[model samples]
Target: MRTQALGGRPRQPRGGVPFMLLLAVLVSPAALAQGASRGARLFAQRCGTCHSVGEGDRVGPDLHGVLERRDEAWLTRFLESPGALIDAGDPVATALLKQFNGIRMPDQPLSEEERAGLYTFFRECTAKGKGSCKPSPTQKPGTDATPEEVALGRRLFEGTEALAQGGPSCLGCHDVRGTGVAGGGTLGPNLTFTFARHGDRGLTPLLAKLDTPLMRELYAKAPLTEEEQYALKAYLADASRDGSRPRKDRDFFFLGVVGLLAALGFIGLVWGPRGTDPRAH
Candidate 1:
């Protein structure tokens, strides 16, 4: 004769809770690795152009031990809205702006999960030390360009250094601030802030394909070399930094004035003048 429970089921094993806890401990590293992997991809897509982990600062400060330096709450808030923090005059944000030459870090659009993943990646990089946080192949280089390399890039863009394939220089169609007396051409969009606008993710592809209507025809036979591409990227990055500072864009100013006058004229034609009442009695 044996005693039996009402439902005739045996009780769960006594060690089950401990076993599950052990399993969780074993699985955590893999989970972290997965998160870090996702973080690496997101970083390359979003932050790799301007920031580095252990390799020292680029456009932004090196983030080797960012977690150690800043608390999680602050990092989360700052990442969510760097511009707002700067505008609010947070000391750290203001100092970072000054440190990075007034190039404001744009606010990132990241879900909570994505932000967690980035944190995991930052932790992984910090644990691994310098040179361990390698950028993926898609990340363009020359972010750590030397001054000489930047100068060479400027020369190339301005046609001071002739292209080996005889392709037209970048200056013919584009403009940048601080180019000498002649300045740059106006055929293409002003390139003063091109790097900031596009980042490496946008820029690398554009350069590699040269697929814009005009660029396609011009560089179809004269493709840029890898070295040339890197050089030009360095120059554009430098110019982008300058564009962050206050400066005048003559073309933009003129166009703005024209637009303002046109708007004023249209308003006048539609409603008479500023103080005129159009109410029907």
Candidate 2:
């Protein structure tokens, strides 16, 4: 356990192993801090051109909702050797190769810690439900709703149609924003956050499924109109996470200049009357 130190004097730092372990433990957090879970910035800088979790669907298939969808064991193996996975006929890996137009995602040799951090980034993305990091209000439909469209979209989502009609409204099966129905009969993922989760493109396709062979027995019979689509899109957009960054964080010095002008006007209003009254009143 001893090593020669300074003038070749014997030293037992940690009795050797304990010191090494302690140093390892001490340096671990700093290493993690420098890793990707700090945010997607590094991953994006180094990897984003070919990948995304926002479901934007660029050169790669949308990585947005993939954590639960892809197997971690498979992810680790594939990261180590993507070509092997493609040749082995791993369904997802094979599909990814074909979907990206046969362009192979290069094998990036990641340390175990780096791979773990990337996994963390994946989980964080899904955790941030449509973007609100702050404790904001429930995301609501805005872009998809014109003043006219909100009511219609809400009605269809909530299933308020007369009960005598037999067929329950859209909420009977698919869930959308503002549907008060509880446990929502689990044929689809819960919509309490769907709108916020899937904006327009992602949500639209599923709505169209209402009449598909699979959903026809349950969802497709109910046709949502074009206008209904717009409203629903609006609802989803509004219910979305706070995608907008804070205004104060942007440019408030301009606001300060304007506020100074308003203060001058207020001073004029108060002083002008008193000073003028002495002579002109």
For the record, the alpha-carbon RMSD of candidate 1 to the native fold, in angstroms, is 25.7
lDDT over C-alpha atoms for residue 252 of model 2: 25
Query: Which number leads on TM-score?
Result: 1
TM-score of each: 0.42, 0.34
Given candidate 2, what's the lDDT at residue 189?
30
Per-candidate clash tally: 0, 14
Instruction: Encode model 2's per-residue lDDT on 167-254: one tens digit a residue.
Output: 3555544443335646233333334344443343335544534332334454344555545555655554444432432133212223
Off by over 4 Å in 2: 1-39, 131-281
Question: What is candidate 1's TM-score against the reference?
Answer: 0.42
On residues 1-281, what C-alpha lDDT tens digit does candidate 1 reach at each position?
11111112122245345433543453344344433367887887689889988878999999889999999999999999999999999999999999999999988689999999999999888888878887745344446678987898899899989977889998876767887558776655566666665565456555655654446678989988766777788888777765233254444434333433343354454356556745423
Candidate 1 pairs with clashing backbones? none
Q: Which residue segments of model 1 deviate by more than 4 Å?
A: 1-140, 243-250, 253-281
> All candidates: CA RMSD in angstroms?
25.7, 24.0
Count of clashing pairs, candidate 2: 14
